[model samples]
Target: MKGVIRTILLIALICIFSIQFTMSMVIFTDLDNHWGKEHVNWAANTMELIDGFNDGTFRPDDIMTRIDFILALNTLLVKKNIYQDVGLHFGKGINISYTDVDRYHWAYGELAILATYISEYGNADIEIKEIFTEDTFNPNKPINRHEVLLLSRAVTTPPIEDHIISFKDVDANIPNYNLIIESVNNGILRGYSDGTLRLDKNITRAEAATVLRRVATDVNYLADKFLVYEDIKSRNIGIELPIFQQIDEHESQSQLHQRFIDAITSIQYSAFVGHIPYHERHLYDMQPIETLWGLKNQNYYNVIGNNYYLIKYDKDLVMERKKELVKEGLQHLKLNVNSSFDGLISFLSIAAELLPMEETMNAAEATFRQSDNSKTKLETGLFIMSQYMANNEMDKGLNIHRSLLEYEFADDIKAQIIRNYGYLLYSLKGADEAIRILKDLKDEMDLDFNELNPNAIEFTFNGLMKQILIQSKN
Candidate 1:
């Protein structure tokens, strides 16, 4: 009878263990499904710099310091080689800039400098010791959901092609306000339905975990990894193992803080992809030109010498149709224009073809003068002349080109300009002067005409000079 009792007791213990294991597995699975899906998507799509997500949980609502945001931005920038260094600098001693934040205070000195984001207000110098007021940076305080959205938007670049997030409540005029709205609009963040941004509220540990997880999954930096934990089996082990691992890695408070730092840096680096709009030709071809017509309605005029021209479209409807044709031509030109010069020339040519000749010339002249440097300004002037010449306005084009020749620029650039000017003279009724200029250019300058575009520099000594000679004989 005693042996029989022992067997029954052993069986009962096994059953209890199995029941606990099953219950834990269920909880783990639920948490994993609930948090992991969104977290993975966010990390993969929004933040791609973070790796090893399966090994950690990100606690989002935890108070974030000024150092945290900076470090994160630095990390993202570093990955893209946008900045040369990563980390912070602090003034020595217990000399925190403000009474509330002392040098020895954790993150005080760092936060003090990072507070420049708020201090950008019309020369208002930020004081560190100042308790973080509403619409200000508070290093010691917890970061709220609204603030998180703001941070996300500030660090990322513009032209975020993502779905917009809608928040029931968020004023557009607060500090870092538009960023918060943009973040939500881009689906990088979300808020409660109560229509409150809750900017001053502290974030909870679990909430932070959820946020971090979302960041990880969206970036695709840490989706595949081994997760291990004791008692994990009891919590629906396999399904929730990843989150447990993350939390376990941050078992100590300091570790948790460091992990947060690392995670933020990763998010910034991999979130945004910047590229020129014209690089993708096939994609641009499919997009309707009407979408870009609104750009033409923004008027710009230029007054050069004795002529005034309007670059702005007078009629919105006609401007829209013209824009569509120009866009189509641009798409076609992109196929043949392999060099940057060719691309630029093609773009200008297309613009000239679509807009009025006077408008194109005025726009080009205005663009040239506004350039901060001489080289770009000279190039713009040359492009304007080139367009004018194409439009049979030789006198106007020659006058602009003459102005360009007077500018002090590099030897090669000057040579090109002289060659074009000489060609322009030949095109008019000044064959003798054109021949003299071309002969002087060939004799004085050591240049490889072959290295330049044959079509672009068609007025060069070898090309245009020969044509002029043949025409003069005829």
Candidate 2:
């Protein structure tokens, strides 16, 4: 049964990531001919990061409040799992003791977290010091243009070096000149048609969303030109494996479980080998346990008997089965929104979205509110971080990945988390830290093989470390 469950999970992982790509475009009524229209849509629709007001107006021209910006920022941070303490103060029955902002205000936790993050890690060189040093957050006040740009730039990496400010209204004498110059050079900050940057004016909500969108879509389009599914398949040379003795049917249940676990271990090694054929052979050879469980036509099911529906999707079937599963997953999430089934349902819905089905987005949104077990919560957090990475939100992803180390997970689970965490560290923090973490992970792999089920995460651990070392030198 566990073997079947593993197969189903692997299938889902392959389906969600390897074989799907389609994104729905968002259309907002208020964005017609707006400079920030594409950005707002990308933020709202593709990234699931923002929304329109109840009447459908985005209020592009209205001044955006300080508290409201933080709230939105915090949501994106949490969705990306960037910081562990992000929403801690906002948990149930928690009271914030700030002097100006009421505990009941919607932005309380966000304000608290932002204040804490800035006070502790904020760049001292930036000119935006008054707001942080103030006793009150003044949550309702509209933020000035300079403050918005400063805050937006803060969430991302500061420029490695300063650039000369060419905008007529800005120069070395201006406050936050370095940050402003960096933002403009990077296209995160833009000048008006007249070439004057309105530094002191209050930015609207639509404008703020557009700025966030700029950070989110900063990836190099050229890098992904060769990353299609067929490219992966074309790179594969078939794998050959030594024949294994048949499993004895007379073996006890425990013995069968042990053999299947061994097969799982082989699957992990196959991933390191980076061969699709080896991975498939391991899956096919695993003995299926006799049970009154599992899906009717498929090979795996959940512990309680829910089927994992993934039809073999060659070009012939195309999206037929995936589309059906997506529909089913959304229905499950809608039906089980606040129930105990939320985590599982949410997982399925999110998996569907890798196919780029927007219908499952609500499931991902609703997951933030649902009560989830530690395992589900951890996995969900990982998924959220992956979304951030997908959208070019690397800083956010780095935080979330780093924070996962605080949890007490089973050795196998921790190993998987470390692999992802290590990758992020390499991408964001540099190689020394990533190399240190991965090296420490080697000591933890000395678990008793007799009692533990085999996990493949450790198989690629050395390979990943080597890769990071190579990249670091370059």
Candidate 3:
């Protein structure tokens, strides 16, 4: 009975200790005022990815050196077994080639492994030219804010929507401004509350711990790339297809959206035979809508809907029609930026991708600048920005939209400007920004999810707003 009692007590004690450890296994004394305190604790105590120099003091604000980051990265991969995913085995095949880092160096094994990987496999997760200009491994060198961008992008598969953030200090023409914008968008780098990126600054120890924790724990970082139907293709299988198709006479708005998703994502079973689905192509965060369609048969129909239709969509027909559209769209460029409506859209889509954006943007900028009427200027800006949204050239589009919004406008024009901006945000999967921008409009306006496509069958504007809010929370 005494033994049994002792065993019960022991089990209870173990469970309590585990609960405490799980709650916060390592507490840092210096992180009381730091924004990344929790991340520091999680990375240190939970994942064992980082550690304090001494008992209970994490020294969270100290600048991290290159070696510290490399070791933290090594721990994240090796200790947590994420290295298996990347096919990295640290000790073997390591060559101590860096002039500064000898085999006896504290971080030699990890540093050597990284060196070997980079030297042999020129195509690393990030471009080699982005980092490592020389043979000297400056392991103790303080990593700059911009350098973290190179590391974070290599480590985390976060979304890459540029011009998503701006700093008061960063000018658009500066060499690093665009990179900083993208880094902020990726959540790898953040700005001060006062709106400065302090681009020249080195990241503190606290910041490094948080960034490392993000790579270790953030869902967006660890998520697998997937194929949603809309990513593979679109509504038209080339040629002219009617907006409404093979009737689901009583389909709900949700069901209609699902149908749209299914149509673009579907394929004939025979067409799937030699294709490798779920390919692990996670070398870098893919740009939006990028997918691996490495298939033996490249031709697949963009089946319009679930139900049968009168038209035949052969592989050859589909390919030829798409080519013709591109060709026609290119030919429409004869009207140049002067084209209106569909012709204008086609020109923008093709030209934005084909022509040098400098030339295209220069011509576009002149048109808006030359317009004397506020309405025409707004319309031109909105039109060009809309094309940018459509073509996934959101960074350039965002710049155009911002310039338009800064101008003083009549209330109605201002409302339209705000709405157009919100619609562009919505297209970029920026649910929060979309809602925020739309709410800025003081009057009743369409909040529908049909900004890009007038005939898009989705939830009502309010419904979609609510849906995305719920999703964002999740």
Candidate 4:
């Protein structure tokens, strides 16, 4: 009787396996698209569920809003039975807050507690009223491209090694930049042909789905199953079908589905993988001075300056080569500086018209230091002040402008300085002071309308005027 009972139990187990295998095959027929096609062959053996909108539109371009991410996450959790069979409902409410999020917002209460991805400064409670800043969570704004990469890294199990996705653009100083880079190294994501990760751009849904599928396969939560999608051609299915088949048969349905969702949501919470090969290439072979002469790639120059310091003495013999390259680069820069001085002066003269206030200030400072003649210094100083009104460092710029006013210079240069100073005061949210200064300059000089190079004067004046007008209206 004991042997018969054991035999009966073994038969029941076989029947259950047969049933599960059949269910997996049926599910394979439903998956379609690049992501589905890749995993379809193995999906029958794997019990993973690939989740996204049913319409076959991955929406790779749309931003993942907070609500959308929460819904996707909850769907994964529900499938996984993470909350248990007792059916503890993931409550939804509009009025949840812990002094950060707005009570009336859609994801105000539920997502914070349920996802638990973010926590208050010192506790587990959600900070509801907290406005999302660059370093903090901002629910409403479109997530940047780099954030998606970081999120993917976080959910990934047994985190990847350091320095995999090396990018020229990502500063090492950025928080958790290294972790995100490692995820790319581990084959979790990829970067574009361009050397930049474009961290500021928003991520789309299709991109997220593709990432999810890759992570799911890596984690052993998916089965290797062969599948064919109606929309995806046989040639395009490639290796993905077999991978899907493997995961489908071996894993539970809930596990497969959760992995898919996790992949999709990873985009908004991670750093972007940059062009690794190119970055390494530039690092090893310092570009020739001629290469940077009239060079368009300022980013490349910045990388060289920041990484291979020409100023420092090092035990590495490569340091000598770097210093020689820097000397050559400086020679080329000097030529450009001299040849472009007049153009630069013209540009600086009407900086308010052509450049941002910050840039204008930069040009002004550069000119003042580089100019050999006192006349040029006075002119550059006036231009600097004119453009400096919009700067956060306006007080510092003003002080320098006042000092220039004491110097004896050519009448033409001095007049330009006075006119520019008046314009600067006007632009710096000091309309009353600006009017008084402008009146004095207008009274003192024979204003040459043509000498006011339109290219130099128009752009800055118009831009400042527009800013002033907008501010006044607000």
Write the residue-wise lDDT of candidate 1 on 370-471 in tens digits: 544444345456566555655778777667666765566555455456555655677675666776766665555544543212223222344444445435
By summed lDDT, which 10 consecutive residues of candidate 3 come out lowest?
225-234
Query: Cα lDDT of model 2 overall?
Result: 0.52
TM-score of each: 0.29, 0.40, 0.42, 0.31
The model with the greatest TM-score is 3
lDDT of 2 by residue, 172-257 (tens): 67655666776675466678888688877887877778776654432111111111111001111111221111223424444543
Off by over 4 Å in 3: 1-24, 79-82, 92-97, 102-106, 115-125, 132-135, 158-160, 164-180, 193-195, 217-225, 228-474
CA shift at 408, candidate 3, in angstroms?
Answer: 45
Provide the clash count, candidate 1: 37
Q: Give the range of the ten consecutive residues with the poorest summed lDDT in model 2.
A: 227-236
Kindly give the number of clashing pairs for every candidate: 37, 1, 1, 75
- Deviation from native of the Cα of residue 472 in model 1, angstroms: 52
Considering only N, C-alpha and C atoms within 3 Å, which residue pairs clash in candidate 3? Answer: 60-206
lDDT tens string, model 3, 1-474?
A: 999999999999999999986666666677887888777877788777777876778888889988788788767756555555556677755566667867777777886665554444322234433454468878889987767765555444334233566678878786445544654665666788998878668888888887776555432223322111121112221213222222233344444444333432333222344332445223222221121121102222212221111122233335445444434433333333232221232233334564567655555566576654343345456556655666778677756765776565654445444444445567674877766654454224433533212222121233334334434544
Give the whole-model CA lDDT for all candidates, comma-separated. Answer: 0.42, 0.52, 0.51, 0.42
Question: Candidate 4's residue-wise lDDT over 1-474, tens digit each?
Answer: 999999999999999999987764443333455453443333223324334344643334456664454454444444545333333444532334334446555555455444343321111122323323334345665654565555544433323223445567778777666655655764556677887777777655545445555444332211111111011112212212111112222344445333332332232122233222554443332332223222213323222222222222122436445445444433333333322221223333333343355654554576566655444454455455444454556666656655665666545444444444444465564644554454454434434433112232222222233233223323
